[model samples]
Target chain A: MKRLLLLLAFAGVVALMAWGFNQAIFVAPTEATMGDVQRIFYYHVPNAMLSFLFFAISFVASILFLAWKNSAPERAQAADAWALASAEVGVVFCSVVLITGPLWARPVWGIWWTWDARLTTTLILWLIYVSYLLLRRFAEGAQMQTLAAVLSIFGALDVPIVYMANRWWRTQHPAPVFGGGPDSGIKDPTMLAAFGWNVLAWAAWGLMLLAFRVHVERRQQRIRHHQTVAALAGK
Target chain B: MSGMNDNSGSQNSSSKNSSSKKSSLKNSRSLRIVVAVVVVLGTIGYLAYTGQASAKSYYVTIPEMQKMGAKAYSSNLRVEGFVKPETIQQDGPNVRFVLSEYESHNPKAQQNPRQITVDYRGSEPPPDTFKNDAQALAIGTWGQDGVFHATQLQAKCASKYAPAQGAATSGAKVATNEAPVVAHGNRTN
Candidate 1:
C-alpha cells in the first residue's frame, strides 16, 4: 500500500511538471524586452524559493535537535535525521537555482556571472550548506550530530542575507518580484499563472524528495544501531 | 545463602560499571556540545563583522565617484549613470559610450549634463537593452587617461520596471533603441 501511494505521488509530480512546462512555453506571453529567454524565470524563481524553504526547515530541525538532546534523546535523533535530509535537499535545489540563473542572465543581462550583492550572497549561502553536508560526512558518532546541528544553525543565518541582498544594495540582478514595492511585479496575468503552476509543482516535488530522504536516513540509523548491538554481543 | 550473596555481589558490580560508563558518556557529550557552541558562535561573529565591512563598499553614483577624485582611481568602483545620447559606438563585441549624471525621465536631459567616457571590453557583448539614455552601471576602475575602463556593463530596461530613485528614467525609451541590437544578437568575445 505504501509503495502504491509513493508511485501515485511520483506520477502526480511528473504530470504537474509537464503541465507547468507547457504553460511556461506556450500559455505565457513573451516578455516585452527579453522575449523567450525570460521563460527561464519560471524555473529559476521556484527553485530558489524551494531552496530557501528547505534551508529554513533545516534550521528549525537543528534547533529542535539541540533542545531535545538531554530530555529526550529519541526526539533529538529524529530532528537530527530531518536536519540532514532537508540540508541535502536544499543543496540540490540551490544548485538548480545557481545553474539556471547564469543561463537566463547570459542573454538578458549580457553576462553569465556578476559579483553583485545578491549573486555573491547566494553563492555564500550555497557554500555554507555544502560545508554543512561535508561536516556530516566526515564527523563520527553522536558528536557528529551535535556538530552538524551547530553548523546548520550558523549556516541558516545566510538565508536572510541572501533574500535581502538585492534590496539592501545595488546589483545588476533584478529587484524582488514579490513585495518589491508597487512597480515591481508581473504585468501579464498569464505569466503570473504560469509562475504559480511552476512554483506549486517544484514545491510539491521538493517535499516528496525530503520525505524519501528522511526515510532513508532513519533506515541507515537503524542499521547502524543493529551493527553496534551485534558487535557488543560478539564481544 | 552464600550462593545468593555471591549473585547479589555480581549484580551490584555490573550495575556500578554500567553507571560509570553512562556518566562518562554524558560528560563527553556535554563537553562536545560546549565546544560546538563556542565554535559556531565564533564563526557567526566573524562572518557578521566581515559581511558588514564588505557591504559598506557598495556601488557609488556618478556624482559620488567624482567626489572621491584620486581615491576613485585607486579603488575598484561601480559607477551608476545615464547613457549619454548618441554616444554609444559598438565595435565587434567592444562598446564605447558616454555616461552622464542626469537622472531625468526626459531623453533631452542628456543635453549639457556632466559626462564621462567608458570603454567596455568585457567577455560578453552589450545587452539588447543597451541604448541611448538608458540607466547604466559600469563596474571597473577609472583609468589614467580620464576614462572609466569598465570590465562589466549592465543596462536596465526602463519600460519593464521603474528606475531606482536618483537613476534616470531615460531607460523607459530603451525599447525604441532595442531593435537593432536584437537583430544582431548578443555575441560573446
Candidate 2:
C-alpha cells in the first residue's frame, strides 16, 4: 500500500510538471520587450525559490540533529540523514538556478556575467553548500556529523542573503518580478498563472527527490550500524 | 653541614634556570599569537575595505556624476541615465548617445533634466535592448572632453518587460484549453 501510494505521488508530480511546462510555453504571453527570451524566467525563478526552500529544510534538520545528539542517538542519526539529503538536493536545485540564470542573462543582459551583489552572493551560496556536501563526504571520525551540521546551518544563512541581494543593493540584475513593490509583479494574469504553476511543480519535484535521498541515506546508516556490530562481536 | 649547603646552592641555581626558560617560552608563544591575530585582522580589514570600495554604489546617477567634477573624470565608474530620444548614433560596436536625468519611461517625473554625452566602444555590438528611452549604464572613465568614454555599455529595456498588446490579456484557461488539442495532434503525427 505504501509503495502504491508512492507510485501515485510520482504520477501526480509528472502530471503537474507537464501541465506547468505547457502553461509556461503556451499560456504565458510573450513579454513585449524580451519576446521569447522571457520564458526562461518561468524556469529560473522557480528553481531559485526551491533551492532556498531545500536549504532551509537542511538547516532545521541540522539543528535538530545537534539538539538530539546525546539524548536520543537514533533521532539524531535520522536528523543527520535528513540534513545531508536536503542539502544535497538543495545544491542540485541551486546548480540548476545558477546554470539557468546565466543562460537567461547572456542574451538579456548582453554580457554573460557581472559582479553585481545578486549574482556574487548567489555564487557564494552555491559554493558554501558545495563545500558543505564535500565536508560530509570526506570528513573523518565521530564529530563529522556535528561539524557538517554546523556547516549546513552556515550554508542556510546564505539563502536569505541571496534572496535579499537585489533588494538591499543596486544590481545589474533586475528587481523582483513578484512582490517587488508597486510597478513590479506580473502585469498579466496568464504569465502569473504560468509562473505560479512552475513554482509549484519544481517545489514538489524537489521535495520528492529529498525524500528518496533520505530513504537511501537511512538504509546506508543501518548497513553501517550492522558492520559496526559485526566488528565489535569479532573483537 | 658544608656538603648540604653546596647541594642546596646548586639546586636553587638549576631551579632559577628552568623558571627563566619557561618564562621565555611563554613570551615567544604569546608574541607569535599576537602576530597571527594582527595578520588575520589586517587581511579581513583589507578585504572589507576593498569590497565596500568597489561595491558601495553599483552606479551613479547622471546628476551625481556631474556633481563629482574632476574626480569623476579620473576613475573608471558606472553612470546610469535614460537614453535621450533621437540621439543614438551607432558606429559598428561603438556608439554615441546622450543620457539624461529625465527618465523617458516616466515623463511626468521631470519636464527637463540634466544631460550627458557618452562615447562607447565595445568588442560586441550594443545589446538589442538598447534604444531611445532605455536606461543605459556605461562603465568606463569620464573624460575632459565632456564625453563619457565608455569601454563597456549595458542597456535595460524601457518597457521593462510589460506584455505585448495582442494576446497577452487573454484568459490563461483559454490558452491551456488549446494546449491539449495541440498535444493530441502531435501524438497522432
Candidate 3:
C-alpha cells in the first residue's frame, strides 16, 4: 500500500511538471515588452518562494530537535533529520533563484546585479544557510547538531527580511507583482494561469525532493546508531 | 617497594598531563570558533555598509538629484524618470534621452512635466526594454553642462503597464507597449 502511494505521488509530480512546462512555454502568451525572456519569471519566482518555505520548515524542525533533545532523543534525531533535509533542498532552490534572476535581469534591467536591499538581503540569506550546511558537514563534535539548529534559526530570521526588503525600500528590483499596491498583479488571465501552474508544479517537485532527503537521512541515522551500539558491544 | 611507588606516581602524573593537554586543545578550538564568527560577521557588515552607501535608494527623483547640486556632480548619482516619448537617440553604445517627472504612459498624468536630458555613454548598449515612456534610471555624474552623464542606464516599464480592464483588446497594447519590469532588481544610487 505504501509503495503504491509513493508511486502515485511520483507520477503526480511528474504530471504537474509537464503541465507547468506546457503552460509556461507554450500556452502563455509571449510577454509584451521583454517577449520570451520574461518567461524566466515563471521559474525564478516559484523557486524563490519555495526556498523561503523550505527554510521555514527547516527552522521549525531545528527548534523541535533542540527542544526534544534531552527528553526524547529519538524524536530529536528525527527532527534533526528533517531539518537537514529541508535545509539542503532550500539551498538548491535558492541557488536556482539566484541564477535565474540574473538571466532575466541582464535583458530586462540591463544589469546582472545591484546592491539594492532586496538583492542584498537575499544574497545574505543564501550565505547564512550555506554556512549552516557547511557546519553540518564539517563540524564533528557532539554539539554540532545543536550549533546547526541555532544557526538555522538565525538563517530563518533573514527570510522575512528578504521578503520585506523591496516593500520597505525602493529597490532596483521591481515591486511585488501581487499586492504591491495599485498597479500590481498580472493583468491577463492566461499569464496568471501560467504562473499558477508553474507554482504548483515546482512546489510539488520540491516537496518530493525534501521527502527523499529525509528518508535517506533517517536511514543514515539508524545505521549510525547501530554502528555505535556494535562498537560499544565490541569494547 | 620504592620502584612500585615510583611507577604509580609516574602513571598518575602522565594522566594529569594528558587531561590538561586535552583541555588546552578544547579551549583553542572554541577560541578559533569565536574568532571565525567575529570575522565573518564583521566582513558582512563592512560589505553591506559600503554597498548601501554607494546606492542608498533605488533611484532618486530628478528634483532630488537637482537639489544635490555640487554633490551630484562630485559623487555617483542615480536619477529616475519616465523617458519622454521620441527623445531617445542612440549612437553606437551611447544614447541621449530626455526624462520627465510624470508617468509618460499615463494619459492622465501631467502634460508639461519637469524634464531633464541624459547623456548615456556606457560601454554596453541600453537594454531592449528601453523605449518611449519607459521608466529609466541613469547612473553616473551630473555634468557642468546640466546633462546627466550616465555610465549606466536601466529601464523598465512604468507601473501603468498593468492590464487591468479589457486585457483582450487594450491589454495587448498595455502589456506589449511596455515590457515586464523587474521586481526588486534595482540601481546603484
Candidate 4:
C-alpha cells in the first residue's frame, strides 16, 4: 500500500510538470524584449524559489538538531537526517537554476555570465550547500551530524542575500517581477498564471524528493545500527 | 529466544547512553570549530558586501555622464542611450558609434540631444541588434580624450516590446524580425 501511494504521488508530479511545460510553451504570451527565450523564466524562477524554500527547511532542521541533542537524542537524529536530505535536494534545484540562468542570459544580456551582485551571490549560495554536503559525506561519526548541522545554519545565511542582491544593487539581471518597484512587474495575466502553475508544480515535486531522501537516510541509519550490534556481539 | 532479545535490547540502550555522553563531549569541540568557521565566513561576507558596494556603477543618461565631468572619466560606469542614425563607423575589428540621450526617432524631443562617442574595442563583435536608434548601454571608463572606450556593448531594439504606457489592460506583443542580441566578452565591472 505504501509503495502504491508513492507510485501515485510520482505519477501526479510527472503530470503536473507536463502541464506546466505546456503552459509555458503554448499558453503564455512571448515577452516583447526576449521573445521565446523568456519561456525559460517559467522553470528558472520556480527552481530558485524552491531551492530557497528547501534551504530554509534545512536551516530549521539544523536548529532543531542542536536544540534536541542532549534532551532527546532520537529527535536530534531525526532532525539531522532531515537537514541532510533537504540540503541535498536544495542543491539539486539550485544547480538547475544556475544552469538555466546562463542559457537565458546569453541571448538577452549578450553574455553567458557576469559577476553582478545577484549572479555572484547565487553562485556563493550553491557553493555553500555543496560544502555542507561534503561535510556530511566525509566527516566521522556523532561529531559529523553536529558539524553538518552547523554548516547548514551558516549556509542558509546566503538565502536572503541571494534574493535581495538584485534589489540592493544595479545588476544586468532584471529586477523582481513580483515586488520590484514601480517600473517592474508582469503586465500579462497569462504570463502570471503560467509562472504560478510552474512554481506550484515544482514545489510539489521538490517536497516529494525531500520526503524520499529523508526516508532513505533513516533506513541507512537503521542498517548501520544493526551492523554495529552484530560487531559488538562478535567481540 | 525472547529473553535473549530482551538482553540485547538492554545492552543496546546502555551502549547508546554511553555513546551519547561521548558525543556531547565531541559536540563542545565541534562548537568551537563552528565558531571559527563563522568568524571566517563573516569576514568574507563583510569584505564581499563592501567590495560590491564600492564597485557598483549606476546606469547614467548621456546628460548625466557629462554632468559627472572628470569623475566620470576615471570611474567605471554604465551609460544607456539611443544610437544616432548614420553615425556608426566600423573600425577594423572594432566599432564606433554615437549615443544620444534622446531617441533619434523622436523628431520633437531634441534635434541634437547631448551625445557621446563610444569606441567599442572589446573581444566580441557588436551584437546584430546594434543598429540605428537601438537602445544601448556601454560599460567601461570614459577616456579623458572625450570618447567612451567601452569594453562591453549591449543593445536592445526599441520597438521589440511595446510596453503599454498607462493603460493596465494593453497587451504586449513580441517583435519577430530582429535577431536576439549577443553579448560577448569577459570584461565584467
Residue lDDT tens for model 4, A7-101: 99999999999998877776666564455687788999999999999999999999999899998998988998899999999999999999999
Q: Rank the candidates by TM-score, best first.
A: 2, 3, 1, 4
Candidates in order, TM-scores: namely 0.77, 0.81, 0.80, 0.76
Candidate 1 lDDT by residue in tens digits, A104-187 = 777666678888888988999899999999888988788989889878988888898788777766677777987876536776
Docking model 3 quality class: incorrect
**Residue runs of model 3 more than 4 Å from their true location after superposition:** B1-56, B107-111, B157-189
- Interface RMSD after interface superposition, each candidate: 10.0, 9.5, 7.2, 7.8
Which is better, 2 or 4, measured by DockQ?
2
Clashing pairs in 1: none
RMSD to the true structure for each prediction, in A, is 8.3, 10.6, 8.5, 8.7
Residue runs of model 1 more than 4 Å from their true location after superposition: B1-56, B73-75, B102-114, B121-124, B141-146, B156-189
Better model by TM-score, 1 or 3?
A: 3
Error of 2 at A101 (Å): 1.1
What shift in Å separates residue B104 of candidate 2 from its native position after superposition?
Answer: 1.7
Q: Is candidate 1 or candidate 3 better by DockQ?
A: 3
Scored by lDDT, model 3 comes in at: 0.80
**lDDT of all predictions, in order shown?**
0.78, 0.79, 0.80, 0.78
Tell me the fnat of candidate 1. Answer: 0.11
User: Quick one: how many clashes does candidate 4 have?
Assistant: 1
Tens-digit lDDT string for candidate 2 (B41-143): 6864665466556554888988888888889989899998877878999989989999887655565426777888999998987776677666678899988
Q: How much is the lDDT of residue B129 in candidate 4? A: 53
